[model samples]
Each structure stands twice: as C-alpha cells, then as structure tokens.
Target: MTAVSQMKCACDSCLCIVSPNEQAVQKDGKYYCSDACASGHSNGEGCGHTGCDCN
Candidate 1:
C-alpha cells in the first residue's frame, strides 16, 4: 500500500495542501496547515499563507 503523504488542511475554508510528514499541524485527529487553522481561527487570524483567506 502507498503511504499517505499530503492532504488538504482540515479547516473548512482553507485551500492549502499540506504534507502529513512535514510541518502539518495535527489537532483532534485532523491535520491543519497552521496553528490558526488548528484552533478554528477563533482569534480571527488567517493561516498566513498567501492567497488563503481562511480565518
């Protein structure tokens, strides 16, 4: 079987694809691209990646 490497960020509004073996943030059994996404953007912050307006 092929090992999973990359997947979309867990945040509903996020458009980023992250590598599970890299810096992807793991939260509640889901993978996110940033801490902001992991926390559901409660502080109204974006993921800091350009072109992604998730907050």
Candidate 2:
C-alpha cells in the first residue's frame, strides 16, 4: 500500500481530511481540522463541520 500522508481529523465525528502541509490544528500530538476539535470543544460547543457532532 502507498504511504499515508494525509489523515482524517482526530475528532471522532469529524469528516475533514488533514494534511501535513495544511494549516490544521494540532493538540496533544493529534491532528485536528479546526481549533474547536483541538481544544476539545473548550473554545466552542462542537467541531462545527457539517454532519459532525464532535463535542
């Protein structure tokens, strides 16, 4: 299999794809597509991504 360079957001319900070259949020060694996910919803109520209920 090809080497994996991109990954889905660390948030359990998020559907965003995160790439090393992209400006994604990093928290506790995990990659998140937005600050809401990185902060574990501390800054906001949820991930805010469509169809995602990460909170």
Candidate 3:
C-alpha cells in the first residue's frame, strides 16, 4: 500500500531525457521525489518561481 498522494515530475532537464523523473509523484499536482530535484527553485535559485516551484 502507498500513501494517499500522487506526485509526478514531468519537466525538462538533461537527465530527464535519459532518466524518467525518478523522483516525482502525483499529489493533486506533480512533485519531485526528493528536495534536490526541486531545490533549484527555492529562495529564487532561478527555479522560475513564476513558473513552477523548484523548491
């Protein structure tokens, strides 16, 4: 059994091309499996906050 959450990370990245979003879930919206994958957007790390939260 898994948690009642569905997160997914279907974004663009060099790694994503060969490797699927190894860290992504679908919790109402797409999400990364870990913070690293979504860390480049927090605190304005060029995450494109205006687009999707990288953090």
Q: Report every candidate's CA lDDT.
A: 0.96, 0.79, 0.39
RMSD to the hidden true structure, all candidates:
0.6, 2.4, 8.9
Residue-wise C-alpha lDDT for candidate 2, range 1-55, written one tens digit per residue = 8765799988887788888457778788888988887877776577667777777
For candidate 2, the lDDT comes to 0.79
lDDT of 1 by residue, 1-55 (tens): 9988999999999999999899999999999999999999999999999999998
User: Any idea how many clashes model 2 has?
Assistant: 0
Give the winner by TM-score: 1
The superposed Cα distance between candidate 1 and the true structure at residue 54, in angstroms, equals 0.5
Supply the global lDDT for candidate 1.
Answer: 0.96
Off by over 4 Å in 2: 1-3, 50-53
State TM-scores per candidate. 0.95, 0.67, 0.24
Which candidate number has the best lDDT? 1
Superposed on all Cα atoms, model 2 deviates from the true structure by an RMSD in Å of: 2.4
lDDT of 1 at 18: 94
Candidate 2: clashing pairs of residues:
none
lDDT of 3 at 45: 46
